[model samples]
Target: MKKQTLLVAVLAALSVQAGAAVPEKTADTVLKPQPGQTQAAVWASRVLTKLHYKSTPLDDAMSEKIFDRYFKSLDSEKMFFTQADIDQYAVVRTRLDDAITGENLSVPFAIFNLYQQRFNERIAYARELLKTKFDFSTDESYQYDREKVEWAKTDAEVKDLWRKRVKNEWLRLKLAGKDDKAIRETLDKRYDSYLSPSRKLTNEDVFQIFMNAYAMSIEPHTNYLGPRAAEAFDIAMRLSLEGIGCILQSRDDYTVVREVIVGSPAALSGKIKVGDKIVGVAKDDKTPMTEVLGWRLDDVVALIRGPKDSTVRLEIVPADAGPDGKHATIALVRQKISMEEQSAKKTILEVKDGNVKRRIGVISLPTFYQDFEARRKGDKDFKSATRDVARLLAELKKDKVDNVLVDLRNNGGGSLSEAVELTGLFIDKGPVVQQRNGENKVEIESDTNAGMAWDGPLGVLINRGSASASEIFAAAIQDYGRGIIIGEPSFGKGTVQTLFGLDRFSQNDKVHYGELKFTIAQFFRINGGTTQLRGVTPDIKLPTMADSDSYGESSYDNALPWTQIKPAVYIPAGEVKEIVPLLDKRHEARVSKDKDFQYLAEDIALVKKQRKENSISLNETVRRKERDTQEARSKLREARLLATPGADDPILVPDPKDALNKAIAAKPASGKTAPVPKVAGVKGALRSDDGLQGSERTLAAELEAEKAAKAAKDVLLNEAVHILADEVGLLKTDTRMALRVLPYAADTK
Candidate 1:
């Protein structure tokens, strides 16, 4: 028999023995490597070893890292497997490298099978504990985050851990006003839901997880996407999908709506919302609802997707609702939903600076996006961030905005081409970024187009979530002295990835393979320093909730180190460095007396205190006291803000889709200019100036007050606008300063 066939036979024999030892429900199905997986494993290993930017050898050291990563991926909380299980699996710890290269997947498959068995056992134990009455009066605690803890030495110890976990769950529900019977039923269903998803896992799913462990061990960004995930990746890049128009994420066997795309059917219905748990799905009114509480997220997505105009019904539990709360069913028509929410949006902020009201055009860019499929098919008007912002800049000019601020806060970046094109719109054509490959060959990527968009004055706002293309654009604008880089340091991801289709490596047409997104190059700013580990530091730094060590690239153990190459030759647009000190000083003076800033500092302190705690008390009284204290503080802040002047006035920022539609509607048939709509004082906008939806108010008064506290005014953006206004005033008074800082402004138009 062939090696692959022999391996399959051995796996089947092992499955039979394991089945005889476990319950029939848990061991009825065993996952084994599919035929195509062996080929895929070999292909992925070859491509990664040869073509990866790091070019790290797949030696013993790498094998051990892969082993630990795989185990962590399987049981990050260290709740399933025992130390004995790890000892037994140690034999293959240093052999995974060879297995991956030689097409031997038996070891990985065997380990996964044991993990599944252990998981089912834990779930069963948890369900059994639900039958016992849990005492909320006990002064015990539960260490929920166990990533750094040692594994239990025996099965009994693991069971003890699960006992505390179950007790904590019971206490949480009881605190949420659930009765004893309801708590038991909710927990019983939750544990069973956990087992259902594990039981449905396929061989392909296990293979994908193991492969990603190997890939991430080599580098942080390198990843393996299975066939289904590959298609999803394409859809994300195109920014369009035929579905109910919401992003879904899997959280503990529950499919949660992460975001409701604006202008999509779900958002129009105003029924679906972020943090809503999708428990069931139905094709139409006639079809019976299929319970999908424990279904895989991709499987649930498949059920939600259909032809345009088709109706899909979903049962959801609201975010504010407890697990035992009521569920509501909503029917929505599927459509080709363009992710217009991610597009660039503009709003004019009127800032009063020493009796001079300066109109600051603030553009919030969520990502650098492009519709690649449409662009490839020769569509001239294919959606892109650059094109949209260019149009917005022209409209801002017509509105007589004094300066422009591009808000890239929490923009995790998208297309590299769009970043370059967008940067081109700011400066008069120069090198934007540099690419360095494995061979150490450096190539410059420049914006060759010559022009300027809103060159009067500019600022780029960023935060820890800004990365890749966002960093590229910000770094370019900063390097050319074109704009003031504001806010927190970026996410520090400077590497570039190239997606490779795995099916191209094999000749067999029947089998569907996945894709590999591997790092191929590193990106450097025009000033020569790479943003690998040290993300772009803003010209005017703002206070952040967390330090760099708490998050960003520095948090990744295997992330690439910061480096520098030869700087690309480029002309500076103006001397922003000369005026940064004055801008920073003025900003500091204003925020020092600002009540909102003081509240922000207090919130940051509270977050830091919470982050330091690794465990929570299981006593219901102690937990409730802590919760009440938090609610009291939130109410105090809300009352203070409400007492401030203009607190009730809504800050009007137009929705991207609404703004685009109005701009189109305002155009005339005679080709004559019509009065452009005033971009201010529109009430009850869907999104705030900070790019987040207004919090949904709950029925509970305290909870509503807490949400209201969170929905306070955007102090950071307001400060940025003030800083820009100050710069405008400084330049207007000094002719020499104007000549030094406003060189590009004269060349505009």
Candidate 2:
């Protein structure tokens, strides 16, 4: 997984009550054809053609076809409508067709009003249907008790449902009083507080509610964002806005921090971390803080993010801590976080086995990011993740690194264009990903650029956060045997959103409606496989605390299913299957004996278990017990590591002489604290073939610090030199090495 992957809002609007009875329309109010109508029709026809809508000479027949399709989608089961209603709808459809074709504004406008009226009636009926418990499946399979529709006939039964809703709301207030009066006051206060907002409910509010209900019926990810939410939606895609630099969600009335960006203000500040519950937010350091305990995530985010350099104070209660948790005010100054900030940085690690050494250059990409704003602004000097990694690879080559590990742990993908471009960096170009639209039209995305940057033994690491473009690139590499993928399943977010300009059609009072964001396309790998619900599977599975399977597009409320398209013509690069067996053996051996692997696995399991727990006892005694348990667990792990075989020996401590001296004395002479020298042989009594092992190596290793820092190349680079040297028997090669021909996945091949 590329580091640039993980980059990725909520609205709270109330529903409205509708009139019990429906109204009828008269013929006199219907639009009459005028002499200038033909000209208007021509204009409308030209506009639709320009917009690339399937115009098909939209006359009476085309209009009727569109109406049938629309109606079927609305009532797919053919329920709720009587024969008479169907006949009436057909007549209305014909009238609407004529109105639209004739370009008569009155008819279409009148039709819209009738549609709204009917939609409201439908909503009222649906609300009533809720009283009659319909079999609603929690899962997508929809396998449930669908034997009968039990309608609530009595007023008591209907009120019971209302009471359940009220109880749920009250429970959200954290009220637990044996006395009825106190609990009642708490419930009333909760309701009053929510209702006290002076914001007036407008027609747009009603539209949003309707749109959300409509979208929800489709799927969870398919959401309707009224014009008001367009700004936020756009910002999410661009991924260049300032906030706590974390994704947030409303998990049961509490806005929880989902994931923290690696180097974001939230992560850097080290104040508000993941799993912390935001209790309240004070804007511009206001004295009166608005309690956000039960606010929607979007509402909370709005308060959190502002203009660059502005500060928003947050009061957070750490999840590890209790309600009376230590509350601190941390002021964060916002900055324009660039794509470069979210990119992958290269680090070389030298792994030693006996006398042999291997250099693994790790490119830890925080995200698959591109400077989209800069690109859009027509700035040719845009920061590109793929390009940056290429440069890093070149630098590593100069150090004579052996292998490359692409760390994409928490990378959420950004910019489809960048994905294709990055995919090109590794292979002889071909189609990387396929995008299938709603119309079944497939668009093949490829790396048009020529050549590969660095094609040594490649391994890509991904986790649950890797999605979309990340999936695209990873799938291509895995399918083509270009690289071995490691980690958990990638996040399945393969849907392409098409933003429709709603303002073009209608206007409500002052604010014009913006866009109708819909899933217009689905992403597929070059192998004709879609990364929709089931994200790309890794080649070498690694231990991850993340439960990517529990969340993401497939698990989402309205996510599209995983499917496939016609396979593109391509061939596997080489046989990397041997590496899989090697990795599996290595992993098993490590898991069996390595203390770090065991500890990491246990830690992940513990965290996952902790995440599943709901309410914790707030009592002081229980809280203290929990804290003590955590402390005990932490100490136990630390003790276990210290007792491990290789670590049990006494170690040398560092002093003012610096890390080099400390490294020389640590446990084994080959110290873990210092960097190993890259030269063919060490000075003094140390010979190239002296072959120091274990504790000796630990103690003898030179502390990689001041000397390495002042040197042209760092200690890590020097270690990499030793690894690559051991590989090709070029340890004595003093000549500087450079990448001769970098490979690129060919898009047009």
Worst 10 residues of 2 by lDDT: 1-10
RMSD of 1: 8.8
Model 2 scores a TM of 0.51
472-577: candidate 2 lDDT, tens digit per residue: 8788888877777777788888876555654554423443443455555677888888887788887667675565535566655436666787998886664555
Model 1 local distance difference test score: 0.78
How do the predictions measure up, each by TM-score?
A: 0.81, 0.51
Q: Rate the local accuracy (lDDT) of all candidates.
A: 0.78, 0.52
Instruction: State the lDDT of candidate 1 residue by residue for 424-448, as single tens digits.
Output: 9999888999999999999998888
The residue ranges of model 1 lying beyond 4 angstroms of the native Cα positions read: 1-27, 133-140, 174-182, 243-297, 303-335, 619-622, 639-712, 747-749
**RMSD of each candidate relative to the true structure:** 8.8, 16.5
